[model samples]
Target: GSFAVSSFVSTIGKSAFSLPFEDGSGAALAADAGSLAGYVYLNAGGTLVRQPGPVVGAELSWNGLRLTVTASLPAEAGISGYTGKPTCVSLSGPVAAGGSEYDVTSVMDGAFRSCKTLASASLPGVEEIGKESFYGCSKLVSVSIPDAKSVGVKAFARCSHLSELDMGGHLRTVSAYAFFGCSALASFDGGGSLKTVGSYAFSGCSSLRDVSLGPALATIGAKAFASCPIESVDLSPVLKTVKDQAFAGLEFRDSGGSVLAHTAAALRGHAFSGSGGVLVAEQ
Candidate 1:
């Protein structure tokens, strides 16, 4: 006779017993079970039950925050028969582990790099994104991180299919190569409090046409908007510096809708060296 098993149970009962191991290497009796220890036994209702085991790769903070250090799946939730890659991931709110609730705060560098199947991500509470966190995820299309303040270098570089990015109102910095080579990105609206755009941050985004620099923006780094097809830019008067080729190879129109004839004030170092026209400084 065969016994039916229920879903994963968080708490073990008094009658639970550890499942037998097949060898000294610590392999469990179940064929698909990983190296994590588990208990399998009959409950009061005569139904077999399994409990959730420990996760292998992650960092727990002293204050109840968790950070994903590696991209590997947990041992208890191993992908034994599923062959398709994960398409969507939601890492928002609190997660329960070891009888304690933890808020997932950040993703370590290169945590999800090259995950080609990842398409969308929602990180509402994450404050910082490490370098190369989602680099080379070709199928990625949308991302929503309303509370994120800083985006590290190469964090989302080479995400070819990424089109929508909601960086929220508190973002302050975009590091170099953050969204480089994302050919499908069409527009960017840097919400309030954005202060700096690092060199080459959005370089090589071929389809980028519209950009809204927030009021607090003060710097535009070298080649930051190079190779894009933008037609005009309404820069903030508080903007203090424009590095070399920052707006290279683009055309600009003035308030009257005519091509600008001369370079604008506060622009230096070939800021518009190769463009058809230069922007007019905001009065």
Candidate 2:
């Protein structure tokens, strides 16, 4: 049942009440009129709270989900949170606060940085991840961002336990140091849509061995895969350039274990520096 804003009694301090919306969504509103002078709505997926202020930002939460609003629009916002120490997070639709519904499309910079307790995250609708969003989250193991198109600089840097990443088919760019120092990461396949990998993107991932550079890959930045144990990678036919030391300390071999030949025109100075691998010109 819907309740008017005027129906709230001041005496109903620190109490909770349930209501049914016209859209058939069930919600519970909790408030502490004594001190917190604000409304917190508990929906199916999460909680949306309107903080007492000029309505600049809000705090969102649920059983295993917590988000802090960073940027607010009339009907949208970017979110990030680390205070609640949530172990698992799942985000799906718009969240309402201060009489407005916000569609969460991005995770703000340094959102969950250094949150050592976080284990996994599923953001099916998020389109972008800002710089250092999950940086230093040492316990994070898996992340699924099916709709994400771009990953910002050092987004997942130093997430030492991160092993699985589902970057979906729409991903195009992985910025510098995005996955740096993710030592547990095993393999990465840029599902036919990736175009650019920035400098040191996967550097220091000692466990990373298998990699599939998508068919659309165009550029590989300096030391992109340095210090990895990767044995081979089939460069895309349309690859335009490989910067200095892109594959340092790695060997390049074909399926038959023979040293694979690369196009000399595409490799910059010392592209294979510190590695036993060699590149030969096409006949």
Candidate 3:
């Protein structure tokens, strides 16, 4: 397939350089990138360490430069209400670390799953959005993740209300299911230092209208934009490859709900299966 978006449109998945690295498959990299066999400590010291929390996903904690990783949250951690699945209806706080002595990065795999009432979220200056970090945060209408370089699988899956995402121009990759099911995400401004966009990176994101691919982008993984209902998409000239099924299920209706011709042509095969809209390319 032609690498340029101007030449072709199709559907896809991605590589190891920056992997969501699920199932600890890339754990071997630890030996080469950094030591994983030792007890990482935190206290404003050496390189930061990310530990897996009781929640099954990774959590980030820092003491200036040093980071620590572990496998559980304290009994009083906000992720879990005192002793069980947080079932309270009250949303409180700038939920700080709570003076608790435990890894902060790891959250219960679904700590905030489908927390539709949440409207705003802020990542601690030191935090990185880990795998499935905010999956199903439907109520999160607006939020930010700065200093975020590497995001894991399903990091922002199903964040239906996210209208905008700012990559801060420093991000390196967009992993599988990174923004999958974020039906309300309209646009994302990536540093596009992004070398790779993985499988279903934006799968099921029906509301994304348009995005500017940065100059540094190189690869577009499978089904990266599957099932999105946008009217048009503008791609960067610097792109080198767009894998199979990378742009599936894409079509848009204007104020009057009419499908634009160019949008239909370019996304012919990539458009969603159930959608009757035709793919049309831009002039």
Candidate 4:
């Protein structure tokens, strides 16, 4: 069924109503607290195509009183298919520390693409972080997605300037280039269900220090942690596979107890092409 958002675009609250999209008329629909969003996807020519579910946290409240997400998303809770301007998104006002959630109707995937100056965001209990979720966010200094689970490929690729990431214990997986060029990230606290780390997950993270792999993760795909400033490879017992070039340009040694040079000799591809560091065997 098609979704509809009413004409009340001043306040961001919870309520549900169906608006008419035919003919030529706009009406205000009042919603309640349990429900918190209203949107109908539009095509390139600005025609309604899909009905977006309840929009939570920040809703694009501009554009002649209408916004559209017509990117053909993956149709999952935390996944994304968002596009266009970064108008006004809602904040949870004031809750407790680690208490408030922005998962009301998570559509963060490609939601804020190339919105480099997005200095504010609030999403929690999100499941899958779609590719390039925050690509090219050059001015993002802080972010708070404490309950995210699976992060899709290039989720934060080329976010050249970001700091203070707070991924809580509930996070699970991370796709390629999850933080490719986020040069300002300092530390990360792995979540619970994260099992896979894809290629370039943290490549070129110039300011990153260290990331403790999740206890349940079993695989580290190629170039998963390629270029960073980390000091060591702190592996978890659940790790099983470290793909070729997974940590190419870093000081990370595999579970094989061999130095990176020696390990790369046995792998399927180069593991230290442009990286700078020493690889000592785990004694």
Candidate 5:
């Protein structure tokens, strides 16, 4: 069986193919998407192509083109054999095998963890990212994952050099410690679609200064945005809940430009911890 992705094709639609891999042990192909995980392909032009080769002995290399993942990734999907030679990685569309297409939906735990040499990523069609998937990738700098829905715990933690994030619509939850310790992260553009932010999601992002949360945000969990240097954020009015220390160590301001205790009606216990600063509600 072979899979091929055509070149010049910019966007691969969701659920366009079906191809999943099991653990890193062997090239164990599956009969369906749920049985395996982590299938990737290199697009050639108008086709998605893959050569049926042994995972252990495969000469895995990304010459210049980006490695596009086309299935839900399993643990160690790109970790065991990858040397991080590619400058960019993305999750898009599906891969074809035996004339059938499988959808590339989510990233599994530790799928790309510790790929210190990897630099950039683009995940336009991904629905979720698993825990510690990109953790400790010191060289990772930018990302554009537009259609993400949920980000698992510690997914991008300790990516010290990461700077840019362009989140897109349809996003929902950000799990605990999703971006913890990303010291170089400067801004987050949660573009028009987000719901809940989990505990300690953005803790220790020292360089982050600006954030644009979408209108659909509802909950901010414990220490969700702690230890950042953000000066202000325009919060959505319909926000319902905020747990303890959600905004600890952040600087906030009101519309009147006066620094005061946040009076948002949805704030729960100790919503803003260190400096009594609260996000200014955006009208």
Candidate 6:
């Protein structure tokens, strides 16, 4: 069986790991670097790589300062497979490079996929969250993203426990399948800044009860809210276009509200198939 060796010796600027000598000629190293607890080691061909990761039972990861000068996170910002399941995760705040601090502006694709025990997250400075960022985080209950402008495809899919999401004021677009299978998501107010809700964006969110369509909304793509259990919807008067089956299988009734009237007039054919409902004014 093979074994690992580590040392406490620190490099000039970045963290480095002492590799197991293949030729077996150097002095042996010991496990003295106890402070770098969550660092993961990977054997790359013959070189050993070290990266920051989640702790044994930590409630958060990426909670400290890091260097950020590249287009994407350095393969270490995302974490998974912790022995002690974490209930909370916060991937936000600042990064440093050349002694200057920069706000973490984006979450990379598939950042926290399959983290089943994660229950909450708060991304403060993030402007864009990539595809499948929190996919399969089944226990996720809440999310708060203060600066997000766009949510990527399937970003929060399969989050069965996700009940609340505060998509702060600056959001512009909700991509396809963004909240697919999020059964517990019950509310969303895309604020006046929202423009587009892509295809299947909120499809299969069966527990969703209501939606407040923002004043600036223009497009609702195909099956945008299909299969939701919403009872009421305040469709924006400014809403112009709705694609195929955008609101299919919903439980909303034509409450005779002017908002519903305007929405009915704009809906494409068969938009509400299962509800035996159409946007008709109340008699």
Output the number of the TM-score-best candidate.
2
Best model number under lDDT:
2
lDDT, candidates in the order shown:
0.64, 0.69, 0.51, 0.55, 0.63, 0.64
* Winner by lDDT between candidate 6 and candidate 5: 6
Candidate 4 has an lDDT of 0.55
Residue 100 lDDT (model 3): 36
The segments of candidate 4 whose C-alpha lies over 4 angstroms from its true place after superposition are 1-90, 93-105, 251-276, 279-283
Q: Which residues of candidate 6, in runs, are more than 4 Å off? A: 1-61, 64-68, 71-85, 96-100, 251-283
Supply the global lDDT for candidate 1: 0.64
Model 1 clash pairs are: none
Task: Rank by TM-score, highest first.
Answer: 2, 1, 5, 6, 4, 3
2 against 3, candidate with superior TM-score = 2
Error of 3 at 124 (Å): 5.1
- Per-model TM-score, in order, reads 0.65, 0.68, 0.53, 0.59, 0.64, 0.63
**lDDT, candidate 2, 126-232, per-residue tens:** 88899999999999999999888899999999999999989888889999999999999998877778889999999999888767777788888999988888744
Instruction: Report the C-alpha lDDT of model 3 over 1-283, residue by residue, as the tens digit.
Output: 1011110112212331232211132232232222322222222232233343233223333222112333332312223212222222222222233233543332333445666556665443323456765677777776655556766788788788788566566678888998888888877666657667789998887777665556666677888877766454444555667776676655543334455432323232222222243334343
Which residue pairs show collisions in model 6? 256-282
Clashes of 4: 17
Q: Write the per-residue lDDT of candidate 5 for residues 146-170, one digit (tens) a residue.
A: 7788888899999999998866777
User: Model 6: which ten-residue window has the lowest total lDDT?
Assistant: 67-76
